[model samples]
Target: MPVRHRWSAAAFCAFALLALAACGTLNTVSGIFGNQINFTAPQLQRYLNNSFPREFDKLGGLVSATLTNPKLTIPPGDNRLRLDFDVGVRAVGAGEVSRGRFALASSLRYDPATRGLHLQNPEIVSMEVPGSGSLIKGGTRELLNAVLAEYAREEPVYRIDSDLLARLPSGKRIGSTDIENGLVVVHLDR
Candidate 1:
C-alpha cells in the first residue's frame, strides 16, 4: 500500500505561483517566489522519505527487490534531479542475494492535461554493490533498469487533480525548470 504524501512539490510550486498573484493569500510564500519559485532539494528529500522501503517482485516472483533510503539531490547548475537509492535484491529459494546502490538523474516535465509532474529522461547513473566488489550481473542489471524505468513512468513527484494549470492568469504557464544553487527553480512563461 502506498502512503499518502501531505507535502507536495507541485503544491509548493503551484501555491507559490498562485500566491505570486494573490500576494496576501499565503504568507509563507511571500519571499519564496516571484516570476520563478525555488523548490529546495531538502524539501523534496523530506517529501520522498515517507514513501520508501518499497518492494518489487519480478521474473514471475522469483526475484524480490526492496528500495529504501532515497537521497535526492538537485545538482547546482543542472536541470536534472539526481536520486540515489539503497537497493536489496534476493532470488527467493535460490539463496542468492545482493545489496547495492542505484542512482539516476532526471529532469522534470509537466502535463497540462493531467496536471501532473513527471520524470523525463530518467537514466541510471550507477549501480554498485560495494560488498560484492563487482557490478550487477547482466540479467539483474536489465531487471533493475526495467524496474527503474517502469517506476519512473508510473510515479510523479507531485500531481494535482484540478485543472489549475489551465487557469493561470494572462496565459501564463510553467516554463523552464532547472536546478540552481542546489534548488529546483521553476520559471513561468509570461
Candidate 2:
C-alpha cells in the first residue's frame, strides 16, 4: 500500500519564497533559507584597522589620545566580541605622555535602516597601564571610556552588504546579531 502526504499552504508558500530568493545563486543557501549571514575574524579586523588610529581631543584640546592596532576576538560562549587596542595619551602643554592598554567587550545589534551591525552596551573588562595598577582611576580613564562609548554607539563594527541581502523589502531586515563560532552571525527577520 502507498501512503499520501499533505503539505500545508503556509509551508508551501515558505518553501516557494526560499526557492525564489535563492535562485540568483549569488547568496548561499544558508543565507537564503536560514536567513543568516556570517562574518569571519579577519573581515571584522580589517574594518577596525581602517577606522583606527583614531584621536579624541574634543575636550578643549587639553588631553588627547590615539587608539591603534585593534585586536578582535570572540571568546566562544561569551556571546560578545572583545576589542583590545593600544592607547597613547599626551598632555597639551606639558607634553607628558602615558601609554595604556584598553580591553573592552560589547554586545552586538542590527539596524534595519542602515543595514549595519553595531556594538551595544560596551563594558570595560580591563584597562592596564604599565608600572601602574589601572589607569582607569584617573580622569583620563573617564575620557577614554567616553571615546569608546562613542565608537560603539556611533560607529558600526560591520555592515551587511547590499547585494548579499538585496535592498530592503519593507519589513524584511537583519535582526538579532550574535557572536558564535568565532564569527559574527547576523539573522534576518520580517
Candidate 3:
C-alpha cells in the first residue's frame, strides 16, 4: 500500500479500537455493555442512612401518631437494617431493547429507646439501555435520581390489605387508610 494508504488504514484501526473501548464492549455489534456508573456500597449506604432517617421519621409519625398510624411503621429508636439493591435495564415490551429497573431487598431494624433505624443489604444501581448505542448520561442520571426519590419514600403502611391485617396477630386493619402518607425513596434498580 502507498504510505498515505497505510497511514489511513492505521488511523482507522486506532479509531475503531478507541470506539470499542469507549463503549466497554467489543464482542458484538451491540458492543460491550455501556459503562456502568455504580453507587458504591458505602455511597449507597450513606444515602439510605441519611434518607431513611428523615423518611422514617416522617413515615413513622404518620403511622404511630397520625390518622395514618394504622400502617406498619418503622419502629422508633436506633435500629439498623441493611438491604441490597440492584438497578439494571431490561426489555419490557416488544420492539424495545431495554428499560431500567431498580430492585432492593433488605431488612429494617429499629430501637424505640435510642431512636435509631438501621438498614442492611447489598445495594446496586445500574441502567438498562436499548441495544442501540444511545446511553445518555444526563438522562440516565436524572432517571436514577427519580428512582432514588421513589425508593426513599416507600412507606410500610401504604399497601396493607384488610384481610391481611385481620390475620395479623395485632388484629388491626390498617391498609386502606391512605396511599399518600409515606416517605418517598428513589434509586436505580438492578
TM-score per candidate:
0.67, 0.73, 0.24
**lDDT by residue for model 1 over 1-190, one digit each (tens)?**
2233445766688888886878643322212354665566665676678668888889888887788999988776776899999988888786547788888898877665545456677888888875553444555677778777766677665553344444445656677766666666667787
Which portions of model 3 show Cα errors greater than 4 Å? 1-124, 131-135, 151-158, 170-190
Ten-residue stretch with the least lDDT total in model 3: 62-71
Tens-digit lDDT string for candidate 2 (1-190): 2233244666788999998877854322224435666776667787788888888784788888888889988887788899998888777786646788888899788876666778888888888766533543476578778887777667777766778777445566677887877767777687
- In model 2, state the lDDT of residue 104: 87
Runs in model 1 with CA error above 4 Å? 1-35, 112-116, 131-136, 159-171
lDDT for residue 30 in candidate 3, whole number 0-100: 16
Error of 1 at 66 (Å): 1.2
The full ranking of all candidates by TM-score, starting with the best, is 2, 1, 3
Q: Considering every candidate listed, which one attains the maximal TM-score? A: 2
Worst lDDT 10-window in candidate 1: 24-33
